[model samples]
Target: MSDDPNRIKALGGGSLLIAWQLKDKNVLIVGGGEVASQRVESILTADAHITVLAPASGLHPRTKLFIELRGDRVTHRDRQFEGPSELDGMDMILTALDDNELSNAIVKMSRERRIPVNAADIPDLCDFYFGAQIRDGPLQIMISTNGNGPRMASIIKKRLQAGLSGLEGQAITKVGLLRNKLKQRAPGVGGLLGRERMKWMSQLCNQWEMEDFSSLDDSAMENVLDKGWERGKRVPKPSELGISRRSTTSKSFSTTSLLLPSIAFFTGAVTATLLLSYSGRR
Candidate 1:
């Protein structure tokens, strides 16, 4: 292998992050241990129909709890994984058996059936590895070391979650709603206009600092839509944006708030902006 970063990594040596919309998809798990329990929790997020093929006595307490709680979607077969017949109709397979022979048999059958499979602690044999994840409702961050450092990935995941706001999940939900409203109001089209519209929306998002969401500058947001938006690609300043907090009682003390052109200044900061634009054009 050449010493280029662009070099294609060998199989099981690379990671491409994606979310599976496994709602109603059949997922067969062949184990009763802790690793199997983890896989059960991970796939449940996608609302998959899960079947655990293990004797009831062997099941991890958590795995049994999951089946009990989500009896509508999750099932415990209380039987050993049979032949290739077990792989039939299964969309995805996750096996955490202590028996290497059984795990390998399932891997081969899964391959022959063209099913994606992941064997516990067996990176080279897995079609995918479950990374350490942080979920903020619709926003999910998965940290992976390409199956090399699960422990490190978990540490990083915890650190990131600690730094993030508790309201981040709710904020994402609000932003998604806002996005939907914008799509309806502006109605994006194709070609140059479409690209420009997309850029404008992106700039709109960029204009909102983290503090903006916490103590949202409602008037400034309106002014950006009303005044600043006509200009393409230029992210407007706080002074130019006419910042005002939605709350009167509590507000974030920030440099941008200090810089906001006051009502005695430029609440209609557009006037100053228009003058600037006119002068520059001349």
Candidate 2:
């Protein structure tokens, strides 16, 4: 909380604004190099339809969308950025171009059109900042120093990536199993009821270790749900889920607390049994 007016708030430092859920939405990227590719890969997990604007668009085999390679500076190619009309109607915009002017122009245009933009290396012109991430299956770990220190974010991300090595996918799968059990038990709780059930299920997941997946079974799920029901009437808020979406989208799980230990377990030293198994194979 500096009054210098030059500091952008880092992620997880008291108050932070984060947005998720860009699935099936249009995401425009104004560059096609490695930096831009990193941003594209980050959003691809959310199922966003990406449109890349570059002089020479490279192949993104995993991207199920269009890539237009204009000449230098985004000339005219198959479905190139025609104009604001092309840039308009996008859910989000990211600029990783080498030219500061182009990036600034894109940011300004996006702002005029009420679109959010994340400009690499330019925080003043950006509406948001991308963080370092660790992914295991559907589980995602995001660490941001806001725009304060990109190096710090990268360091933390690398540490987490090492610590949460294998457990990312396992933790997500375990939670899914628990959530499904809750959903089945309370099929009629559409709005508040269904969400509360999910909330309690998350609590259960937090209370138990990932290795003890048995603790997240049907009986445990029901017990957690019943306890929540006993608490009386309540409406859930967006902050509860860390990142909330519209009704059409599933609520994002707040893995901030849950992902740490799981990452450590997955990436840390293996257990004696695991070591024995590896030795035997060797």
Candidate 3:
């Protein structure tokens, strides 16, 4: 390998970007300001149980509404933070207080207690920084600058959005459904049939290209699963199945594709079901 100064060396002393699995986990937010509310939205999507610990007078209007509406997932303390006892048994901590001294105190106490903490707008004291994300159905492209440049990450996210396929999410949805059907169709011993299913799906995605996924009609899907596996034969393409290629720039799922439920949710600055729309040129 050529020695390049710009090469990725190590994660030493720098942040490692990760998708934290927070479902059903408990998280504590030390402040109820706007930034704290923003934190709630991000963590809320992870299906985590969140408690905003700040007096009622300090809560941002939007934050209050989220706590009120999403009561199933959120709750408020309605009082100012006290001390170390408040930080007990927390899986994670987020500080959005304007009080620097209090922020420092919480960060120090959290470090002592070994809980991961994120101090908003104070990168130096944070253990994690939220990154920008581009969501399309089951697909996500996460962008980050290791807590150094959030704005830059947003810029990259927008660029990716512009170039993404509008029907890509639909394609992914169809492909995922086909995978489930394939699993039910083939059930051998432990690793035996699983390998075959994975190999075929890989080949399908690799050979057909992304947009071609949307061209797979019901008949084509059946032919691929049935005849293709009959003689240990290869899966047929949409063209071979007598289907015409779809426009890469098309923004909607082809009428020929399976009917998918349109499910999504969006709120201020938080995208729960951001199956974003995009289309590429043919």
Q: After TM-score superposition, what is the CA distance of residue 133 in candidate 2 from its true location, in Å? A: 0.5
* Residues 150-186 of candidate 3: C-alpha lDDT, one tens digit per residue: 7898888888887776668878987987787777788
Q: On residues 224-276, what C-alpha lDDT tens digit does candidate 1 reach at each position?
A: 55565545446566556555434221243344476664653775777889989
Instruction: List candidate 2 segments past 4 Å from native.
Output: 1-17, 57-82, 162-165, 190-207, 214-282
Candidates' lDDT values, in order? 0.75, 0.63, 0.80
Expressed as tens digits, the lDDT of each residue in 111-170 for candidate 2 is 888988888888788777778777777667778775678789898887766554264476
Superposition error at 154 for model 2 (Å): 2.0
Best by lDDT: 3
Q: State which candidate has the highest TM-score.
A: 3
**C-alpha TM-scores of all predictions:** 0.72, 0.59, 0.77
Q: What is the lDDT of residue 75 in candidate 2?
A: 25
Please report, as a residue range, the 10-residue window in candidate 3 with the lowest summed lDDT.
Answer: 273-282
So what's the TM-score on candidate 1?
0.72
- Scanning candidate 1 in windows of ten residues, the lowest lDDT window is 244-253
